[model samples]
Target: MPDAAPPPAATPLAPVPRLDAAALVAALRAHTGEEFELVGPLPGGQVGAALVRRPGRREEVLTHWGGASDATWARVARTGALLERARDAGIPAPRYALVARLPERIAVVQERLPGEPPTRVDLALVQEMVAIAGRGAGLLRERRDVPAAELHLLRSGPGFCLHESLAQYDERTRRLLDLVRRIGTGHASRMAGDDLVHLDFHPGNVLVDRTGTVTGVIDWDSVGRGDHRFALVTLRFDLAVPGTGAADRSARAAATRWLDNRIDDLFGASPDGAATLRAYWAHMGLRQVDWAIRHHGPDDVDRWLTVAAARLA
Candidate 1:
């Protein structure tokens, strides 16, 4: 008998196109029927932003929310609606003018708020932003809207803490994960609230003027209903990440102290505040460590683990 023919190999999936400045500019021009001059790229985590100047219009930011599944896009739509509510409440957020849902990517054109991200984050400005966020939270509390399944705390989605990534780390990190797992058991209940939370409330997402006034709090893609205090803890960890530049490092140190003071104040306000803070800390720690494991190298994981350990202690 003749030898059986070899089976065909599976076809490889095509790589997704990079959402660079040129690509974004083209996409914007195509979707909006307007010409755009690329200004520069803005810092982002899950998404990418570009500053573009349209003819006879103020500078606008075009955010490329990269390709996502339909479910994820649904969540983004809900988040956009929530942000609209927040903006109506006078929160410093952008106005979404156009949202283009394409086959391979999503692009949003937003009104560019004035001021730049502070080279050195001022704690006073951070506090003001947090207060504004709290008011937005209050608005969310009145509306009994539930986010999509993917936006839930326990969902194994991007930015949500998952346990599988812990296996990629060292012994010390594993030990920390043990504590985190224990603390996370009833965390959903503890964190349950109607307040809208910015899951990534870091300094980079906050825009400030020359006088250190927070002009806008950008990046509301991960906005959802949760305990507002959870965001405060996320900001604490964000301020502690080691930066590559001298100014950033100095800012991190000062901001860390400021966050520490804020945490202390929270603890002093209520007897159970410590436990609540610890739970939120574990959630933030897991979120950071898991994110580092996937997107960064061992050194980054170690740096985040150090922050996690300090919080656990």
Candidate 2:
């Protein structure tokens, strides 16, 4: 029922729990007494998400929270309010309608927003997403209670941005891990500042219409406080990777180059600009590489390796 519990990801990634959609639906019914109909899993999900609807309510996305820690839940608690502020600031992030802490596992019901994941991150979308990042430039400055973003550059993150995958994947990843550790030693451990940080900011998280205008940004599960510029690094890594349906290789490369130039232009002046980017890229390198190792095929891993090798080195 839960997609056959994808064969346990290889060691290191083994800790990463595949989202159990059927179990979540059962948990929702048992705990909330809401008979919601499953509308199948959402596509292009780095992590799993599903669509659900009930008779009287509009469709909402259901996110499984099987492997998140208490700290993660704590962040989720404040996320709703933070998203509200983000909305007020003109960033179209989805709001958490309900966080159901069932015995089976935590399940999050989020407000379903508009648009679909764009097939490609063309120049227009890149510019738009970068502009949207500016809207929440100092969003969390006053929210002293929220946790700053964890880079996990040096160490393994809770379940996602792992280090072992790189250290053990291959010679290429092993070298990348060395650089990550070096950057980690330079003190980029915790992302500092008040700007809103969506750790997983990428094309998959944002939705757009045919004309490529971003309709909404979803998947705020990893939302936290940090220099929003960090998101640029994440987007850069996500865009550079081979997948993403960009039919024209040259165009994809051009878009990524454009974003890289923008990142340099924007972050080059900050005090810790280079250091911070090295750390962000390191974390993203480990995250994407490890994900490819665990969830994708060998060809995918090789493609990721080529992209990561080019950047993290």
Candidate 3:
């Protein structure tokens, strides 16, 4: 058995696909003439992945995805090439060893990059993460092939960034949903510009070494082109989450505020900055809240509501 990838790029995720290591192993063998064995479950991704080893040589990360349209998967297949550009700009991303597109799913085998998931989140970590986000600014400005990142506030996205959860939660959430919907409809349906948007940019998706330097940014399943500042907003919401790290609640709040201040420092001079921030903020709010409502219990949802209230209220 193996873990699945992120859900589709269209409609609701009903009967989704799963990852089969044997099928991928077969696919890789057929495509690249490689022999690999499933190692273990790789932790710390919204979509699950597994470690696959090429004995006596090196290891690779294996991911299997489905439900996205062929066009979407085609765009996804191009991400590995996009990584080359990211690497050129000094960003640490992995290279795809192979891509096996089967009738039911897409299997990807990529060269494994270094570092383990960061065990804790601190101010230094925050700064480094924000720096990582900054490194991606305008990286894709010239690449017209990549699609714009959808805000997903006005409606549900493929399988994540849902909007209906907030609408059903309660009066408070419904009001917040209204704000998010207003922003979603008022702003462009998709994010503008050509920056490299790690649609799920957060500490969890980042891998780091012992000294706390980020070695690689993993999980580009939903990667797209958009304003890099949107990533900071996503990071902001993640920091505001209860156990994302930094010792305690107050410290997490401080780290989030510090990040916001950094955004202000960079964007306070630009007229569109606040507006851009708010739109992204509302989108992330809907994403987190919707996921919490559907997956976690009431308290978890409540915590996210507090986070949303900071900006949406």
Candidate 4:
């Protein structure tokens, strides 16, 4: 039997959205000529966004709240343009079109790429995307020579990366902060140069087809100049701790093993790569804890923070 091609890289997570579906549809319909049908919801929560199927069309329409900032809509437009540029650059990206932009929301009607939701947290799939992430990192490193700083998630400072700037989070936030400090300060690993990092890479964001063939790597919102190793570590963290308890240990280990080897293949299993990966692991974990605290309620916040604290301890 022929070995199947690996799944595509994960999509970058979007800012949580409180979508106004009706309003978004209205705006989208007004702007586009095609009819869009109501498909089932995407896997993530309502705040995450939904998938709308266009009848007789191979594409999907993704809608999300642009948050409160007046520039949020503009950012969506810019993101679409960037995706187009990336595709032209020979990157594996979905065909994208911006259909509408309202004061409160934005709608992107884009090609629905092949592949199913990631099954069993495969490391090969993770590395497939990490390689792309590294490519993105290389791009950012090249772009650093340009006079202008590209608008990207990497532009956020240490405070944002560490989650120290948000005002509303409480105890959970503090716990995450403490962990961030330990992870960021630990001298185990360090690297210089600002390469692009896709801070979010998980099974939920990745896709794999039935034959294990990776079709297209979607999502580019978080692409920016930063540490590429950090991006790889962020994806690897989820595999390191796949689930809440012992039942998933074997799976986690398998995934980890695959990633460990792949990391070595791409970056080489050298002291420098190891150190760089360690730094990224710490940063990525801290970021997850911060996100859980800020975006989730008491139950989730408490759970993630506890896990984070234990790791730091």
Candidate number of the best lDDT: 2
RMSD of 4: 9.5
lDDT for model 2, please. Answer: 0.78
Name the runs in model 2 displaced over 4 angstroms. 1-12, 67-73, 243-247
TM-score of each candidate structure, all chains considered together: 0.80, 0.89, 0.86, 0.67
Clash count list over all predictions: 0, 0, 0, 2
**Residue 151 C-alpha lDDT in model 3:** 87
Ranking by TM-score: 2, 3, 1, 4
- Relative to the true structure, candidate 4 reaches a TM of 0.67
Name the weakest run of 10 consecutive residues (lDDT summed) in model 2. Answer: 1-10
lDDT of 4 by residue, 86-178 (tens): 565555666665446545555666777777766555545665766666665544444543222221122234323434422235544544455
Q: How many backbone collisions does model 4 have?
A: 2
Candidate 2: lDDT of 13? 53
Candidate 2: tens digits of C-alpha lDDT, residues 1-313: 0111222334545635557777788778888898978888888676688999977999999996653567656666788788999999999988887887766457889989988988776777888898998787888878998888888877888777678876766666677778878878888579888998877888888999878899999888778888888888888877766644546566668788899899998878888778777777777777777787777756666666666666566
Give the per-residue lDDT of model 3 (tens digit) for 1-313. 1122233234332322345566667766676666778787687665578889886968789997774468757776778878888888877888898777766667787888899988777777889888877778888878898889888877888766666556555666667788888877777888888888788888888889999899998888777888888888888888866764336666666677789898777666778877777788888778887776666556666777777777667
Task: Sort all candidates by lDDT, best to worst.
Answer: 2, 3, 1, 4
Candidate lDDT scores, in order, read 0.69, 0.78, 0.75, 0.53
lDDT by residue (1-313, candidate 1, tens digit) is 1222232243212223335878767876877787788988766544467788877998888876667678767766777788788778777888887687766778777888888887676557667766776775565656675551122224334434655566435555556678876766655533556777777888788888888888888888777776676777878888776677887677667767876887788665987787777777777777777766666556667777878878686
